[model samples]
Target: MDYFLQLVLNGLFVGAFYALVALGYTMVYGIIKLLNFAHGDIYMVGGFVGFTMLTAASGAMGAKGGLLLLIVVMVLAMLTTGTLGLIIERIAYRPLRGAPRLSILITAVGASFALEYGIALAYGPNPRAYPVGMGTGSFNVFGVRISTGQLVMVVIAVILMIALDTLVRRTRSGRAMRAISQDPRACLLMGVNVDSVIARTFFLGSALAGAAGVMAGAYYGKIDFLMGFIIGLKAFTAAVIGGIGNIRGAVLGAIVLGLLESFGTAWLGSQWRDVFAFGFLILFLTVRPTGLLGERVTERV
Candidate 1:
């Protein structure tokens, strides 16, 4: 039982990362119906940005100021990645908005490649050791050992998710987003600047991905340019599992995927983790394409 409980705790921590990244996927899909494949690269960018900042500051800040420095680095990384997301949406996606879906999708793929290679060109094709970490201190509760770093990461993730939820449910911008998602033409007719709203959506979503990236780097202790690729797909799977356009569904789906991976890893081996995750994705697509919380919408032909 203790072993099972430990797995569950670990799963929740892993799920926090998925939840952050998946929110971006769902938000972009919700607003413009575009699957920004490059979104994951934005996450990679965040990690690199955080890495750069930490590397520069680590010597001066020392261990005493580690927490404060980390907070500042995360904010800067989020801002940088958010701006990058806005640029991608404006330059890559906006031009192809009226074009066929396949065209935009290809462009998204191109953008992803561009970001990945661009980072590699700048940072080299080598894995970077994170300059800072959340320390290796842990405590046990009910015989389930939990790391402080994981607890901190989960708390921050939950706060961000809650803030996003409030924004979506209560803010005017969020209302515009929902409105555009339902009927962009109608929202445009109703005097909403659909383009601006879409841009904001991309910004916010990418910002969340950025936060996840920084957190992951701090926790895992290493990062690389291509790191976002697999995680990006996993996050997309999480979005789909929860219903692509539903905010709460994305979080729920992330937790579900995380738990699945945790238990699967324990049962099988770590080497089979990706296979387990993708396999479950295939199963979900086959059984319920709309997702657990996704509703079937009948579109006009």
Candidate 2:
């Protein structure tokens, strides 16, 4: 039972990270029907930014300031990545909005490679160690132990997710996003600033990814330029599983995928985790194409 609890806890943390990144995937897909494969690279950028900030701060504030440094660095990284996301949208995606889907997809792939290799060239090909030590202590709940870092991370992630959910569901910009997603042409015709809304969506989604990246680095204690590649695919899988265009579904799918991977790895060893994840994706696609919450709808007429 303790082992089960441990796995569940781990799954929830992993799921939160997945959900954060998956929101970016789902948002872009929902609004533009374009899968921004380079989105994961933005997460990597955030991790690097946080790492740089923390390293710089450690010199001034010492190791005791880890918590404070984390908060400040995370916010900075989010802003940085959010701007990068906006720039990428303007330079890469916007131009291809009217182009063929294949062209835009190829461009996304190119952008992904560009980001990966660009970071590798700048930071070297090896993995960079996160500066701060995050494994400080643990707390017990009902005989189950949870690390301080994990607890903090989970709480931060939940807060961010809730905030984002509210923003999308309650805010004017969110209404604009939904409108654009449903019908960009109609939204434009209805006097909505479609481009501005899409840009904001990218900004918010990328900021969440950036925040997740920072937390991942803090928890995992290491990061690399190529770290976002596999995780990006996993996040995309989560988005698909939850219904690619649905915000809430993305969160649900990510948690489900994370739980599946967590238990599967425990049962079959870590090497088989990806295999299990992909297997589930295949099953979901074949069995229920619309996903858990996706509604079937025909093209707008």
User: Which candidate should be chosen as best, given lDDT against the real structure?
Assistant: 1
TM-score of each: 0.98, 0.97
Candidate 1 weakest ten by summed lDDT = 59-68
Candidate 2 lDDT over 190-265, as tens digits, reads 8998888999999998899999889888889899999999889999999989998999999999999999999999
Model 2 residue pairs with clashes? none
In the range 14-130, model 1's lDDT, one tens digit per residue, is: 898899999999999998888889999999999999999899897776643476688789999999999999999999999888899899999999999999999999999999999
Model 2 Cα displacement at 212 (Å)?
Answer: 0.9
Identify the runs in model 1 with alpha carbons over 4 angstroms from their true place.
Answer: 62-65
